[model samples]
Target: MGIQVWFIVLGVGAMTLIVWDGKRRRLKQRALSAAGISHNAHAAGSAPIPDLPFEAMLPPEADTPTATLPVNIECISGGSRIGSATHILGKVIADEPVLIKGRLEGTLIAPNHPVSVTASGHVASYIEGSCVDIDGYMVGTLKANTKATLLSRARLQGVVEAPRLECKAGAWLQIDVAQAASRQSVAMVS
Candidate 1:
């Protein structure tokens, strides 16, 4: 009888711990959501959050075409990021990798590093990088020195110039393929 009682107690304790941990996680998730930090895994398949005023997150030099912004201050993991709530209308030049989760309407130049656009990102401008990966919506011209990849959820219109181009199964592309010949000559030479 004592052994049965101990087992019951242990089961109850485990259940209590599980409940408490679930509540704790809920509270933490609520706190993070209120603070504009979202967990990507938890927010998957949900409707996009409304745009917030994220202009203050931009570097002061973002509007200046000639200015080079430092990577360390704006980077999230050695790469620069444009948050989901931000929208910029000018040029962006980065020496390091760039991840876009917002809206950009001008030029993005990262000639030596990769540039990625997430599923929530919208870019209607020119993108130049070493490698470009798009999982969102983009219209205009994209130039990548090495490769350009359009993911399953990506939608692209206009032109793409890359030595290697990959379009996933579900991606939508309406491009002008005639002007995408810049790297073909170089590829043949090498």
Candidate 2:
């Protein structure tokens, strides 16, 4: 009976030691993580992340595409001044506002400018800008400075990459909304 009791006590003590060791290891890991110390020094030097603007995080290269310039359409003949009958059918590049009262069917690029597609506009191309306001219909990708906004009547079909987004009622966005909204909110403030 004495030997059996001793063996049980030893077993319990071993379990306690194991539990204590596990706790100690976890604490050590926490301390290391808090200090920003990586387990392997070599891995940190291989991949260097860039601090890119909110819109240019993807497509890898930070430079704008030099192969083609964006098309710019100021107005369409016979189209309503407020955008009654216009159709944009090619790439657009500009440093000014593009008020559309017609249709756009190409890519729109504004590296350092903002683009606003009014409620009467219908866009079917990718949009890259410092700021994008969509109150119309967009069927392509949208990348804006920290945020992309969809007014009440705005409709989107393709991917949206913005650190922030604002989607009012009746706005139709197919991708993630929460993250986009957060990004946009941050962009607006900063």
lDDT of each: 0.67, 0.56
lDDT of 2: 0.56
* Model 2 bad stretches (over 4 Å): 1-82, 176-190
Q: How big is the positional error of residue 32 in model 2, measured in Å on the Cα after superposition?
A: 58
lDDT of 1: 0.67
- For model 1, how does the per-residue alpha-carbon lDDT over 132-179 read when each residue is reduced to its tens digit? 998788766777888998876667765677778877655666564323
TM-scores of all candidate predictions against the true structure:
0.55, 0.48
Per-residue CA lDDT of candidate 2, range 103-132, in tens? 665567775666777766776546777767
The 10-residue segment of model 2 with minimum total lDDT is 40-49
